[model samples]
Structures are given as structure tokens and as C-alpha cells.
Target: MNSPLSPIDFEDKRLKIKFKLEKRLQKELQALTKDPPTGVKVDAESIYRNLSEWIVDIDGAPESLYEGEKFKLMFKFGSRYPFDSPQVMFIGENIPLHPHVYSNGHICLSILTDDWSPALSVQSVCLSVVSMLSSCKEKKRPPDNSFYVKTCSKNPKKTRWWYHGK
Candidate 1:
């Protein structure tokens, strides 16, 4: 008969998953460097050092409400990436003033939550964000931005976002 796995065994398994994730992320980083998606710039070194985190720069699309503005997105990945979605949020001082983007940088995008799919890649997410920004008709923060910012967790992923509208 076999005994139950110990806590140490779980830790070891987690470490192995992390290692695999690192390698996969490295490949993604290399691909991004070679042919980056439009409006997105990623720091390969930062990703290499810490495969679980990435900081990306996004240029606002021309003629869009956010034209001439720049924003930074922080992505935090777990060992179950590809199977799980990355915790992405706008960082830095210039968070976009969009109905879907909160004052605190928590983006209420369905793709990042309930609609997430393992098939989605970092580049795809960037494009989706760009598309979301481009489709906005007005430049304004969410109605409950202040309240959400004050009460939400530091990690946007922890919040249960209620996505509504287009």
C-alpha cells in the first residue's frame, strides 16, 4: 500500500511546475523579442530573471481617446499558466481613463477572467487590450472607481470583477 504524499512532496511538485513554466516563458520571451506585437514592448531581461512576472509598455493607438498616452501593464503568472490566466493590471502613473479600467488599474475584461483560455498568448492579450481601448467611445473612469480602488486587493486577480457591457 502507498502512503499519502507529504507537504514536502507537494512543494517539490510545485517547484517542478515552476521550472517548466520558466522554460515556456523563456521561449515566449524570445519570440516576443524577435517579432513583437504591435503597440506592445516587453522587457526580456526582467522576464528572464523572474519568469512569473512581466512589465509591458503599451502605446495608445492613434486617433483613439488615449492617443498620445502611454501605459504600463504588469502581468503576474502562476505555475498553471496556459491553463490559467495571468494577473494583468495597468501600473505606473498613467492608467487609462476607460470605463473598463478602474482608477486603481484593475481592468474589468472578461478575457482575463471568466473567458480566459489556455490558447491565449501574451501577444493576444496585448492586442485585446489595445482593441478594448480603441473601441471606447468616451474617456472616463468606471463609476465605482474610487470605491473599488479603496477596497480592492493590491492584486487585481483577487477581486471578483463584475464585467458588464461592451
Candidate 2:
């Protein structure tokens, strides 16, 4: 006969997983700080205390519709990060008015959702966002922007976004 695992045992297992995740996050953060991607700047203050949340400042690409504009992106990581996509959204008063960007700051980028891969890093994501903005021809919100803003959750990760071709 075999004995079942105790509650204490389960707690211990959970702690171990949490510790490993935190260590991985720390390493990633360190690497990111040493060499961040172009136009992206991570908020070091938040990373000093917590690895689960990060604030990044992005500069709009030159000659683009958003040229000379500055935007702030908030990234929330789950324990399953690297394997799981981070929850990213534009935060602050000056959200971009791009068609793929909602009025409430939710972005409709495919890689941030269905196309995400463990191989993608924070740098790649930032670059991709910049590329998306640079390729835009119009400065406007999505067609359903009004309806989506009114009904969407505060957390962009919770929403099921329908991505159109680029």
C-alpha cells in the first residue's frame, strides 16, 4: 500500500516551484538590464523588489505616425513565464491611437497572444511593437474600439482578441 502526499508536502512543492521561477526571472532581468533593446527602457525600481511586474518606457519610431511620442507599457508575468506570454498593455495618459491599439490601452498584437513562443524575449516583443507602429498608415483606433473599451476587462490578458492580418 502507498501513502498519499500530505498538505505540507504539497506546500513544499509549491514553494520550490516558486523559488525556481523567481530565480529564472532574476536572471532574465539581469540580462535585460545589461543590454536592453532599442527604444525600450525597463523600470529598474520595480525589478529590484519583484520579478513578476515590470514597467517599460518606449519611444515611438522616427518618421512613423507616432514619431516623437512616448509610451509606457506595463508587463505582468505569471509563474509560468517564458512558457506563458506576459500580460502587456499600454499604461499612462498618452495611449497610442493606432487602429490595433484600443482606447483603453489594450493592444491587438498577434505575438502577444496566439503567436507567442517561448523563444520570444522581452526585447523581441518590444521590437515587434515598434515595428507594428512603424508600419501603420493611419492614426486611428480599431473599428469596434468604442464597444470593446466599454466591455473589456481592465486586464488585457483576460480578453480574447481577434487578430487581423498585418
Highest TM-score model number: 2
lDDT by residue for model 1 (1-166), tens = 9989899998999899887878778888888889998788998877788778899999999989888799999999976897899999999999999999998888999999889998887888988999999999989998888999889999877888787767
What candidate 2 gets wrong by more than 4 Å, as runs, is 1-5
Worst 10 residues of 1 by lDDT: 157-166
Model 2: pairs clashing at backbone N, Cα or C within 3 Å: none
lDDT of each: 0.88, 0.86
**Model 2 root-mean-square deviation:** 1.8
Clashes of each: 0, 0
lDDT of 2 by residue, 1-166 (tens): 9788799998998898888878877777787888987788887777778778888899999889888999998888887877889998999998998989998889999889888998887778888988998999989889999999999999888898887687
Backbone clash total for model 2 is 0
- Backbone clash tally for model 1? 0
lDDT of prediction 2: 0.86
